[model samples]
Target: MDLVTLTVDVVIALWVVAVVVGIVRAIKARPPRLAPLPEQIRNRFEVGWERISGRFLYEPQWAVGEADSLVMSLLSARGQPLDHARLPREMQQARHDAAAAANGRPRDKTEAMRQVLLQYRTVFERNLGPKPRRTAPVPRREVA
Candidate 1:
């Protein structure tokens, strides 16, 4: 075979190898599918979320910290990436805001805490499923 033809064949082979390696790397980089949490665990997280949300009005800073912790716990329970660098953008931002609020860095710490709560809420809803609906108590009939 001519030198030029041999070189061309070698280049094609190298390109094919590179493509296959890239595909393999991409597949390995993807996160594994997360299994659904058990019903009891999910309910516990829901109750925790409610308490954290309720505390937000009275103690914004403390509530933000609790919310952050709860979110991290939920993610951990769900086998999610826990590293700050690997966490989703929204979660990263929420963590940042929570830290800021806890450290009293922001001028409007309450507002910052509120945003953090909202971001964490999104994460909670996504991972723990939607918040359960609360039905109003039915009125009792008067005795005749």
Candidate 2:
């Protein structure tokens, strides 16, 4: 074959290999599915969610503690190690200061509370079961 034809062939072969590798990696990269939550634990998480959602706005300190408590509870129920639930050092200090400050400012407390809520949700979901699938909302049919 001519030099130009030989180069073209090589390039085509490389392109095909690249495409196949990309497809294979894409397939392997999919997240592993999580198991479903047990009914009892799901109920517990739901209750905790309600309490935190209700009180977080008005009572930031209490909400932060509640979030931590919820994570602890889930760990207890699952018989997991407790250290996994502990807040980071900075967060711990922030929480402590928030507690000590009489008439604590909500701004500082709110950031800590938000972190706690995020931690709780992550820990709760990890222990509870597989991630829930998100479904698209169904469109309503208009009557003619």
Judging by lDDT against the true structure, name the best candidate.
1
Q: In candidate 2, which residue pairs get closer than 3 Å at backbone N, Cα or C atoms, i.e. clash?
A: 34-130, 35-130
* Residue lDDT tens for model 2, 1-144: 999999999999999999999999887555334445677677878788788868877886677677667766665565543452343343345445445542546566567566556655665566666545668999999999
Q: Write the per-residue lDDT of candidate 1 for residues 64-89, one digit (tens) a residue.
A: 78888898899888888788766767
Report the Cα lDDT for residue 122, model 1: 95
lDDT for 29 in candidate 1 is 66
Model 2: lDDT of residue 11: 100
In terms of lDDT, model 1 sits at: 0.83
TM-score per model over all chains: 0.74, 0.46
Residue runs of model 2 more than 4 Å from their true location after superposition: 1-37, 83-106, 131-144
